[model samples]
Target: MPQEKPDLRNLAEPVRFKRALTLLLMTLVLPGSAQIAAGSKRAGRWAWRVIFGIVAIIVFLVLLSLVWRSGTINLLVSPKTLRLVQILLILLAIGWAALFVDAYRLGRPLTLERNHRLTASIVDGVLVVLVMSVLIYGSTIVSAQRDFVASVFGNGQKSKADKGRYNVLLLGGDSGADRIGTRPDSITMASVDAETGRTVLIGLPRNMAKIPFPAGTEMAKQFPHGFEWKNCGHDCYLNGVYTWAMGHKQFFPGVKEPGLLATSQAVEGITGMKVNYYVLIDIAGFQHLLDAVGGITVDVGKKVPIGGIGGPIKGYIQPGRNQHLDGYHAMWFARSRAGASDYERMTRQKCVMTAMLNQLSPQKVLTKFQAIASASKEVVQTNIPAGELGTFTDLALDSKKLPVSSFSPVPPLIHTGDPDFALVRTKVAEAISKSEALDKAASDGNGKKSNTPSKAPTKPATSGKPTGSPSKPSTDVDDVASICKA
Candidate 1:
């Protein structure tokens, strides 16, 4: 009451609130998962506070912007997404705090600045985050992707009978050429059972020979008068088959050719499931997907050299041991081979893919939801409708143990003229057979089996498994190429 000259803080109020709001928004919107819990705790830390704060804040802001659409709110997310959102938020808060410190240093009176600076910064950050969270979660309430497969897949309702087991085709592509005839480097089929919550991932090497497409004999036919039969590694390259047959007809998503259709048909015939869901993630798309997932943790089984492959992947990298990698590095790990054998590459691909999946969960992806979704759209072409996709996710949410197992089928069971190709084809077919039977068994048991099947089965912890070269040791087999400098 000593008649303090009418505290002219009104004009400053918006400025104060502005700073706070900006910080808050940055905090919530950021994509780092750490931001959610340690937000307050991180604020109390000492060394390199500015770095942590800014990094977190920037991450949160990016994530927040990603979550909330321009005009929509879609915050009702599962746990993993939520956790990711929170982590991102914390990162944003730290970022905001750093900026706040800078603002205070450039400005005036210590008492006022100190009194309001931190509070203003964090509150503002939280408010912005809250608003963004709501928007991001709300917009996708009826995600379009959910619609494409909804009619057939059901809305996470219905009895076990409706859920059924599934055979999903996962294609990893290196479209060095146009999308038209680019072959898939890696092919994986996943068998998932909702009731049992079991999942198995099997790998198909690129050079597999003697692949029988679902089109019966029709799949092997050449395109035109002078066009070569689509025979690539075996009688025909898988990619060529797609362009030759499916591209013109447009039967599947990103199916540019009948290759996918034929492959699907073959798998369906083998598994007896409609082969309901197909996800084609090209190399670029796969890279983006891994990037969106914030990189993955993988293990290097042995000393490996890279950059020897004839294409863009020619270089030698000696990874020290089990390590972590971001999107680009992971891609390299999946595709590199200075001294790696083909079988080694197969193992590496599976390891990288599994590591990528392990990184996603409801609680971990909330903040980065939009980026993930965007990345998914660009990188992946899936046949499962959006609604069905949601159901699949929801089912994943419910169960822990899925019924499945995976292994390459390309063992050199028999010697052949084209040794490597023969082994690859054999393994791919064998893997497909195993996956199909396991998934069918799960589906059949959904109604007849336990009311609640656990989550998908976990691949045994082979984090330290070696990436070994495979050559047919059969009496009649021949090595394709001499071992590279390992």
Candidate 2:
């Protein structure tokens, strides 16, 4: 008898559709499984290997994070690692999309009924689009991070802190295309304890006169007495020092950032603390960054003006508790200087910083990764080296466990116009001592304390005293988070 003819009947239309759907879904849930079921076994095997490799990396990173968080953070922020990860993400996306197409081919939809063929094609197309979209989006985020790292950091070795504390000069300034030079409108020194991450913010008024530079710096030599520019009628304010230094770059010959260096030295001289580094934030672009992270919530102490300094007054941010503000409103809230006293503005700015620190948790950062990464590149410029970021990052995390207290040398504590450097340094030391004592108490009590540390002094002290009384201390220091509770 003739050999039995092989059956050539096509699978039922419904059966073909169901198989196509299964293969498409399988490829999505477990890339390459569909190929193993119906296509080239070799391709399927390769796909599995890729999947396993990715899974292994994820597990390794997770383990590293749990065991050595600081190391993990450093590695993640490393420029070389970031570049490598960006390339790998793109390759993974391309490979995943190809796998979806292969799964469709293995299904052999061409031999199925017309309707089933159309349905399979649609499913295959959708899977490709979805996988590509997600992978490409992730790759973009990685690329942004890499660019940000490269732009902001140098290769300088991490500097050691002085007296177990790192004093960083934080400047908030506005630089417009129409404007001449950047003015550091808001000046604050962040004194962070190297061991405990306890912090104290020392605020200085912008218009404070007789600002002195470091002992050996060029600015100090030129002024000798202080930052007194003769052209400004022998009265140069703190903020104007930047503009003066910029104009008189010859005084700081060969220096790349004369203004910044001079300002850093001025802050050092004023606070009587060694300045580790400086961070200058552009207030004009500040709103964009704030909006990117879904705006910040702050306790509005009073009505803050929106505009009216240069142009017409727009409106006012009404006083309220826990007011959620968008980028435009948040910038105005921090910067509006029309009606509010400079000291009040400084206090409000401190509150803004406190609110941001508490609210911009890890979860929020991850969720708004793209917007934040983009905005960071535009808004922030700092001398903080890439090598030192991990140290500061670890310290910042530690700082969150305790309240952030601030000291403003605006009024009765020390006259800003003619600040007594010795007195300022004494008060700063006293503040640090208080913080250390509080930490000691917490440790002694095994994380249980009957009374939290008081934010301010309960007794007043005479001027020039090393340790002010409780009432006087209140003027200089405050638990910003509690004061600006939302």
Candidate 3:
């Protein structure tokens, strides 16, 4: 018998169109292609499927526009509706998990079973609509809430800046109800390079000393009466810790709030950068804020399948790689010290942030939109100015192609000292040298790196304790001390 001719509909497209369509799916994964990939057995399977797929995708786009706003604002979803949606998402996730495994193992266009036109047409069509809706709506909620939550939690008091690179001192504190001692968790100097639109984060281990800030004479100037700002027995350096350059007297009649000037001044002097802003959040505040923003998105990676205690995750977000983290999990990820040390914990914190950024991608945010917006309630705090926020949005969106850079604690050159203030001074001096170099390069317009990139970064002479968030803040000289002592 002669070979049978292929159906016109099932026949593949011309070389160029096929190649273009395939390329588009590789990155875009449009709903139509997804539905077409479902089943087979039709006479004009390819043509008919693609046609229907386009129509379905249009539906997906329209649905996305309708629910986009719901993701950003704190919409009141009826509990019943919310539960139903959650259940549907769960079911979709299961289906996605199956498809995901197959796609990974077999690769695309690799057939899994005999094509079934009728079944594939119906199921694929429904699934495409359902999945697309979740993706678009979910992500929109998460991203919008992530940025705005900072303003809400800070109580209308966020960081401020102008057209140039803006700097902020990010501080983490260990204050908690169960804490043995209250101290800074970690300090990082962070800066946003407006020109390059890149973010730079630096970690300052609290253990390092000889920092600068509490000007040696600050004691005499601000707290001539003592460190007690509102009360005679209050912590002397407490107030100064939150606002850069503020002065205070010694507390405990003689005991100091560590060294006041050494750490702060050293940081300012070394980085050659100004101490424009600072803020301190207690452990409770950090944890509470995270809970408020519905929690951040975290990706589970081979890096950490088994947690600090070798605990099994009952669907603890699978270990391979994923995003969307809640406060509870993120807290442990950043704070877990079981098998990891303070340094390792900082790295984990950075990972959490990176995962958040990945999930915030335009395509992903649309799915988790509602949860993201609701969570933004108490999770973040910053000092970036309102005017700069619009600019920042543009910069962040463009950051995809921008080269991201980060540095580690400098070594041997700096160390913690007996008098806390003395060690702070040393750190400040080291940072100043760096800041000055960058400033000069920026002035000359010969620098490809940001105006705030660390001039130099090396492991500290010794392993020290972490005192702030994993990474440093933008434009902060006192970050090292802030993270360590917060």
Root-mean-square deviation per candidate: 12.8, 6.2, 14.6
- TM-score of every model versus the real structure: 0.54, 0.87, 0.43
Local distance difference test, candidate 2: 0.77
Stretches off by above 4 angstroms in model 3 are 1-163, 180-183, 214-270, 276-327, 366-370, 410-413, 418-486
Cα lDDT of model 2 by residue, 222-275, tens digit = 878886656445438988878878888888877888889889888888877888
Q: How would you encode candidate 1's per-residue C-alpha lDDT over 1-486 as one tens digit per residue?
A: 475433335547546445444433444444322233223344434324644765797677567645532211222233334455555545544554554343333222233366576665455455545555554444353242232223222223222221356657877767764444656666766755544444555554454444453333344343221123333323353334444454545434453446666666544433333565666777755767778767766545455554455645444444544465667767777766566555567666655654544446655566665566667666666555433443466445433333224555444542222334334445545554554444455454334544233232332322223222222211111111111011
Candidate topping TM-score:
2
Ranking by TM-score: 2, 1, 3
- Residue-level lDDT of model 3, residues 172-194, one tens digit each, is 65554554344556565555555
Model 1 lDDT-worst window of ten: 476-485
Q: What is the Cα-based lDDT of residue 364 in candidate 3?
A: 46
Residue 417, candidate 2: C-alpha displacement in angstroms: 1.7
Global fold similarity of model 3 (TM-score): 0.43
Clashes of each: 103, 9, 114
What lDDT does candidate 2 reach at residue 259? 87
